[model samples]
Target: MPTIPSLSGLRGRNTRQPAVGRIPVPMSAYVVDCAVYVDGKRLPRRFTHADAIAEVRERGEGFVWIGLFEPDDEQIQGIAETFGLHELAVEDAVCAHQRPKLERYDETLFMVLKTVRYIEHESPTTANEIVETGEIMAFLGRDFVVTVRHGQHSGLHGLRGELEADPERLCSGPAAVLHAIADRIVDSYLAVTDAIEEDIDEIESMVFAPNSPIGAEHIYLMKREVLELRRSVTPLANPLRRLAEGYSPLVPDQVRSYFRDVDDHLTTVSERVGSFDELLTTLVDATLAKITLQQSTDMRKITSWAAIVAVPTMVVGVYGMNFDFMPELHWRFGYPLVMAMILVACLILYRTFRRNRWL
Candidate 1:
C-alpha cells in the first residue's frame, strides 16, 4: 500500500488500537487502485487524486477511474470534493445502507447497488443464513468515475481487470462503468437464486416425505429469506428501466442497450424469487394440514381404548358389591362364568375398534 504523507497527522491521533500483535492499518489503504485511461488503454503508472484530476482536466481525451473499499468519511471527503460529487449522494456513499437506486444530481449520475453472495447451509430452516450482502455506489461524471464499496462482497478487482482487458468495450466512457457494475450485481442475483433453489427443492421433498416430515417453522424461515432477496433486487427495476429507456445523457444509447440486457436478467431473477416465496407458503400450509390430521388420528385411537376399558371396569365393580342377592355370587361356577363373559365383551369391543381403523 502507498502511504499518503498528508494523513500522517491523523494517524498520530489514532487512540483506538487493534487486537494483540496486529498493527492498525490506515484508512487510506482502502484505496484499492486509481488509474487514468486514455482511448481505452490504462496509463503507465499510478496517479494521486490531484494528479489524476489534473490530467483529465488538461487532456480531454480520457477519464480517471478510482476504486475504493469501505472508506471512512475523513478519507473519502477530499476525493469526493475533488470530483464535485453531490453532498447527499456522498453521504449515502459513506454511510452505505442505501437501497438499490439511481439518481441524477446535476451532471453526475449516482447509483446504489446491493450485491449478494450465497452462503452454503445444510438445510432449509436455516435459509436466512444463506445470503450475504454488500453495497457498491458508483458516481459517474463526465471526466471521471468513482466507486465506493462497503462490505465483503462488493469489491471490483476482477471486474476492473476484465474491463481493462477489453479496452474497446471500456471506451464507451463513464456509462460503460455503470453498465458493468449493474451487470455484475444482477449476475450475482442469478447465482444466489440458483443456489437457493437447491435448498427449496430439499424443502419441498421434506414436505412430501412419507412418514418423516419437516415442520412449518423451517418453511416459514425460508419464506423470510426469499422475501429478503426480493427486497434487495426488486426496487432497482424502475431505475434500470429509466436508464435503458428514458432520456439520460450520462447513459449513452449503446450503453442503454447493455443496461436493457441487464434489466432482462434482473426480471428473470425476480420472478424466480417470487416463485420460491409462493412455494414456501404452500409447503408450510401443507405441513400444518398434515400435522392436524395426525393429531386427529391419535385422538380417535385414544377414545376407542377408553371406551373398551369402561365395559370391563363396570362388570368387575358390580360383582365386587357384597350384596347377598347378587346374580353371579350364588354358585361357585358363577364366578368363572362372569369372568368369561367379561373377556368375550372386551374381545368384541377390540374387534369393533380395529374394524373402524381406530386402534
Candidate 2:
C-alpha cells in the first residue's frame, strides 16, 4: 500500500491563503465534514474535498465521504468537478425541493430522500403545523459518497459518529455509507409517523366528542400536513425498490439486502401515512356532518319558538284592529278569557315541542 501524504503537507500544497486585508472563509462554512476511511475506520486528519479524494485514490484502499449543508452551485462546483457528478444532479442538489428519487449518472447513483419531523403542540386541533419536512440528497460512487442536506433539522453529525463507532459496518465501503443514510432516513419516517398517529388519534377523539369544538378547518389543516408527508414519502418507494434489486453497480449485493430492509421499513411508513390521510378525510366528513346536524337542530328550535309566538301575535293583531263588532271585545270577562286562551295555547305548543326533543 502507498503511504498517504501527511495532513500538513497536503494542506500546504492544496490550500490557498487569502490576501492579508481580507478575512478568509473556511470550507467548513458549507462543507460540514470531509474525511477518508480506510478499511471502515475514519482517517484521523481532516481533509478538503480535493485532498480527501486524492488521498483515497492514491492509496487505492479507502474511500472519501464528504457532507455539505445547503451549498450553492458555486460552492459545490469544485466537488462536483472532482467527483464527475452529472450537471443535472448537481443542480438538483444545489437547489433542493426535488422529489425523492434515484438516478444513475454513469458510475454514480444519486438518490434523494425526504426527512420529516413532527412538530409538537398542545393539541392537533389547535396546531397549525403537524409535520415539518426537509431534504437529503446522496451521491454514491464506487469510492466516494457525498451528502447534501437542505433543512435545519436534517443534520447527520450523529449519524457520522454512529457509523464511526461501528468500523465493521463502515468497512463495507461507500455503499455502506449510502445504506446507513437511507436506513437513518427511513427510521426518521417511522418516528414521525408514530408522532403523527398520536396527533390523528387526538383529533379523532375530539371530532367525535359530544359538542366538540373541533372544526373541519382543523381537520383540513391536518389533512394538508398529511398530504405533505405523503408527497415526501410516496415517491421514494420505487427508488428504494430499484436499489434493493441492484439497479446500480455502486451498491453491492450485501448493501442491496440492507436496502431491502430499508425498503421494507419505508413500506411500513408509507402504509401508515396512507392510513393517516384516509382517516383525516373521514374526520373531515364527520366534522361537516356534525356541523350540519347542529345547524338543523338550531333551525328547529328557532322555528318552534316562532310557532309559539305566532298565537299571541295573531290574537293581539286582531284586537289591535279596533273593529266595532269584534267578538268578546265588550264581554265582561273577555280580557281574562283571552289571556287564559293565549297561555293555554302557548303551554300546549311548548309541551309538544319538548316531547319531540325540539325545544
Candidate 3:
C-alpha cells in the first residue's frame, strides 16, 4: 500500500500556518471533522485543521484528514492558507460548480467529483426532477487530505466511519483516502443507474400499452433528467483514467491500481447513461407515432358518421322543398318509401364502415 512521506524535521520549513493575529473564524461552523491518524488508527482527540497538521508534524509519523461542508470563502481561507492550497483551486472549491477534473499544483493534487442521487417519487412520468447532483473537492498533499463538500447529500461522515473500521486500507495514507472516495462515488453512480433503469422500464411498458395515458412531455422530462445525470457521470471518466495512469506522484503505484478499478466502474456508468439517452429518444418518437395513429383513427370515425348522417339530410331536404311537381309530395306511400330508402342507405354505409374497421 502507498503511504505519505515522513513528516519528520519538516515542521516549520514546509508547513504553512495562518497569518498571526487574524480574526479567527469559528472552525466548527463549516468543519465536519478533523483527526490525526498514525499507522491507520485515528487519534482519540479531536483537533482543528491547524492543530491536526501541527500534531502530525510533531509526531513525524502520521497524516491529518479534514472534512468540511460548503464553507464560504472567509470560512475556508484559514484552512487553505494553512494547507498551502493553490489560489485557483481554493476559488474553484468555494464556488461549488466545478466540472469533475484533476490538477496538480506543485506537490498537491486537487480533484473535483460530482455526486448524484436518484430522487424517488410516485412516478417518473410526473416527477419534476429525477436526479439531484452535488460536488466534492479534495486536496491531497504529502501528509494531509482535505475534503470540501457542496451539498447536503454529499456528506462523507459514513465513509469516514467505514474507513476507520478498516485500519489496513486506511493506513495507505492520503492517496488511499482519495481512492476510497472515488470508489464510493462511482458505486453511487451504479446504484443510481440501476434505479433509473427501473423507471425506464416502467415508462417503456406504459408507452406501449393500449390507451396509455403517458404523454411525450413525460418522456421529455425524463430525457432532461438523464441528460443531467450524463453531465455528472461522463466528464469524470478522463480524470479517473488520468489518475489510474500515474498522472500525479501523490498517487502511488498500489493506489493507482485501485483507481483503475474505479475507472472501469465509471466507464460502465457512462455507457449506461448514454444508452438511457438513446432509449428515451426512441420513446419520444414512439409516443408521437402512437398519437398520429390515434388522430387518424379518430378522423376516420368522424368521416364515417358524417357519411351516414348525409343520407337522411339529403332525403329530408328534397321533400321539404315543397314543389308541386315533386314525386314524394303527392303520394302517402312515397313518403314511407323514401324513409325506408334513407334507413337502408344509412345501414349499408354503417356496415361498410364497420367492415373496414373505421367505426
Candidate 4:
C-alpha cells in the first residue's frame, strides 16, 4: 500500500493563508494512492504529503504522483497547500463542472480534461442513455503531479501502474505522466468517435429503409450526444500543442516529441467530430423530408377516396328530394338504371385516380 502525504503537518515556507469562499468540505476517506518515484522507480518507504515535498527538495530527485477520487474541499485544500495550486483551478476541480482547458501558474501547469464513456443502447432516441461524461484535473508541478478525478470510470489507477512498468518512459519526469494521461484521454476520444459513428450509420440505415418508421427524434438525439463529445474533446487541442512544443521547462526535450503525436491524434478526432455533426444535420433534414412526402401521399389517397364516393352521394342526395317529376321515379326499371349509372361513375373515377397515382 502507498502512503498519502500528511497534509496537516505541512508548515514553513510552503504554507499560505487559506483562500476565502471556501466550502465546508467533508473529509473523504478518499485518498486513492500516493507514491514518490526517483529515477522512475518507487521508493520503499511510505511518506506523507509533507514528507514527499521534503524528500523531493532534500534529495533534489524524483517526482510525486498523487491520485484522488472526488475529494472534499478540505482534502483538496490540503493538497493545494502542499503543491501551491491556483485557487481558481482548485475551485474548478472541487466543483467538477469545468470545460476542457489548460492554465499555467508560474512553475506549475493546471489541466482539465473531460472523460467520456459510451453508453450502449438499442435505440438512440428513446434509450435516454448514450454518452456519459466525467472530469479529471491534473496539476503538474516540477517535481510532483496531482490528479483529481470526478465521476465513475474516470480513475487512472491502471494508467499509473502501466506507466510504472515502463520506467524508460516514466523517466521523463512529470511530463511523462502528463503525456500518458493525455494519450489515454485522446485515445478514449477516438473510441467514442468510432462508437458514435456506428450509431449514426444505424440511424441512417433505418431512415432509408423502404418502410421503416424511424423519426427525426433519433437523429437529433445522436447529434446532441456528438455535440457534447465535441465540446469535451476540442478545447484541449491548443494546450496539448503547447506541451508538445515545449512551452514549459518541466516538460523535457525527450518527452516533448510524444505530445506532437497526441496532438495529431487529437486532430483526427476533432475532424471526425465535425464530420459527424454535418452528417447528423443532413440526416435530420432527410428524415423530415421523408415525413413530409409520406404526409402528402396520405392526403392524396384520402382526397381520391372522397372524390370517388361523392358520385353515389350526389345521386342519393338528388333522389332524397321528394320531387314528383324526378327522372327514373316512375319506371320500374328506372331504379336499376340509376343504380348502375352510379356504380359505373364510381368505377370510372377509381380507374382515373389509380392511373394518376392519386390513390
Which residue pairs of candidate 1 clash? none
> How would you encode candidate 1's per-residue C-alpha lDDT over 298-321 as one tens digit per residue?
999999988888888999888778
**Ordering by TM-score:** 2, 4, 3, 1
* Candidate lDDT (C-alpha), each: 0.87, 0.91, 0.93, 0.88
Candidate 2: Cα lDDT at 244: 89
Q: What lDDT does model 3 reach?
A: 0.93
Give the per-residue lDDT digits (tens) of candidate 4, residues 164-229: 888888788898998999999999999989988888888889888988878888788788898899
- Model 2 gets an lDDT of 0.91
Q: Look at candidate 1 and tell me the lDDT of residue 85.
A: 91
Task: Assess candidate 4 and give its TM-score to the true structure.
Answer: 0.90
| Top-TM-score candidate index | 2
Error of 4 at 98 (Å): 1.2
Model 2 clashing residue pairs (backbone): none
TM-score of 3: 0.89
Where model 1 places Cα greater than 4 Å from the true spot, the runs are 1-27, 125-128, 316-325, 330-335
User: Which regions in candidate 3 have their CA more than 4 angstroms from the true location?
Assistant: 1-25, 319-322
Cα RMSD, each candidate = 8.0, 11.4, 13.7, 10.6
